[model samples]
Target: MSGKSGASEISLKQSLRKIEYPSSAKDALNKIVDLICGRITSIKNMDLALDLMAEFVFLEIDRRGHKRGFPLTPLIELQLIELLYEYFNNMSNESARNTVFLSIFSGTTAIMRLGVLTKLVSVAIAIPSATILSSASAWMQQLGNTSQNSCKLAEGLIQDYFYFYNPNTSSINLVPSISPQFTANFLTAVTENYFNFTKRECIFPPKVLMESVTTWVSENPGLCIAAQQKQAVLPPGAIAMEATTPIAGLLRWTVLAPINKQDSQVYGDLHLALLNSIIEIPKVTPPKAIYAQHLTGPINPILSYVNDLRNKQELKLDQILNEDNLQLALDRYAQAIQVIYSVNAVYGHVDDLFHQLKLLPFNKLMSIVISTYKKNKVIIL
Candidate 1:
């Protein structure tokens, strides 16, 4: 072995010596194997580790052949996966977290590449065992701060789990191993805890990671829209909303995300549709007591502002251009917009009076008059 490989092996050995495996024999054996496999990178070191692991496997088989107590490598593999899941929750140093994540992610994908996870394990456990880690890594790589090398490794694994594309069968099918949002929640956790990304930050996953959701949404467009409408009832910071469909979450997250780019125009229509389709807040059939009290607050403002505007419209051009009049006009316009939003929040049906107001000349004049007043007020002030 080269000097670096020898040093790595020595480091590996020192780390193993420090590990205090729990009293359970199976747990202890699995921990030792995990430590050995996770540390050795060189072929020479790997050969030694493999020999040691093989000897342990044979000894266990001999000792418990009739009892069926040989350790399940697949189960051990799942235990190793916990290290990754835990890292996302803890506020560890970024460099250390990335190193640990990349190490396990790369090792798992390498094992996956050899078909060891599928071919060695029984079919019942095979698919799910291979899928859980592989799918999680796919989302992490696509959404997290991953190296190009790590991304390439994750891409290969994603092909196996996201959509099982088979050349021999000439068929591509979505894998039922995991939901898009289940893995997406991992990203949300890591970004929130590890990266400190604020809720407003737009962390768009790579296109490959979103393919399954986008494909499903395309097929069930109506259902997706209905799901989003239900999602709208919950507050933006709602914990329950996370249980909704992944597309609904993504749509709300990317409410301000740009869809005008050349590559994104394809989704612009559906995105806009979902954006506009969310149900209005303060339900149309609110309790009479609440509506009566709340509605007046906004309705009173609209009445006052509209009457003020009518009085101004009758003023001479010179009077309308006065500094005080211009300021009042600007203030009232601002108040009008606020009340408009408030009224819409309460009675948001198409046939509602405010909804009809949007189609009338008054709404058009408000837009034109607000702009003109803002300009004239600037000069007067």
Candidate 2:
């Protein structure tokens, strides 16, 4: 199923990327949105439409870096919400719902690119919050098997669209034309709405929070860069697994390193816990993640070696994480994380997670617990 979805996604993105923008970027974007939204007949088609929208925006940004940002005119706003509404209304098709929601993440990344390029940043998404929230509520009421993925995606989409507070100026700089208090109140309302839905609170902090965290992580050599060491000989029939991103590199230490590596059941339990945490469900009734069980065996022994130096007290905190020792620990682990995340769909950029963790003065961890009503769970480091 995923293989077919991947092929379709690739084909759609390629088709869109190959188109030459003979006209202005705004005109091209308008035409593409119109064409894509007009063709939305089924839930699967929503993914294709979002893919086309994202790829065109990406291509525009690539061709002309920060030249002109696309404006979210009333027409385009209506078209986008209408397209999303189509998917939300027909979300009973579980497979299609899952596939299209993943596309929302990619679509969001494209919009965020536009957000950074624009001088008055909120031009990326100008849709009214009430329209989106009401549509979601209506969808939930109509469907018997309400798609939780839809809720997650919708909440994330709205949050990202309006996440434009500028901490440096102590004001809303994303859309300077609007009232700062209006934007702040809008965010507060959106946050409360989702808290009611998910039954846990998460702040849409200033965009500068993410920026500051990423920059700090990137600058710290010991934290971001992997260490150099002679490759260790793996046991017979074992292959290597490497971390793909700096964020994943950090997780290898903070989250994965301290675990009892010889235990597949422990990894399975960990995977299950993480899944339950994301879906905001009770731990005792957590959903099964068979993929994690399948991959944990190969990952165990290699991971056992990841903390050898630390176990011996030979390296400091940063020194242990600074090295690429977690290379074997990340690939399959990261893949498992992605699958579990997709299965029990949670919103927010995965990369932003590590930065948020870094933002804590003592590397404190924040857990959004379902048990907590209108509050976030904080774990001190």
TM-score of each: 0.27, 0.24
Backbone clashes in candidate 2 total: 2
266 Cα displacement, candidate 2 (Å): 22
Off by over 4 Å in 2: 1-24, 39-254, 257-381
The superposed Cα distance between candidate 1 and the true structure at residue 189, in angstroms, equals 6.3
Clashing pairs in 2: 227-323, 227-324
User: What clash pairs does model 1 have?
Assistant: none
Candidate 1 local lDDT, residue 29: 40
Worst 10 residues of 1 by lDDT: 287-296
In model 1, the Cα lDDT at residue 93 comes to: 36
Candidate 1 lDDT at 249 equals: 36
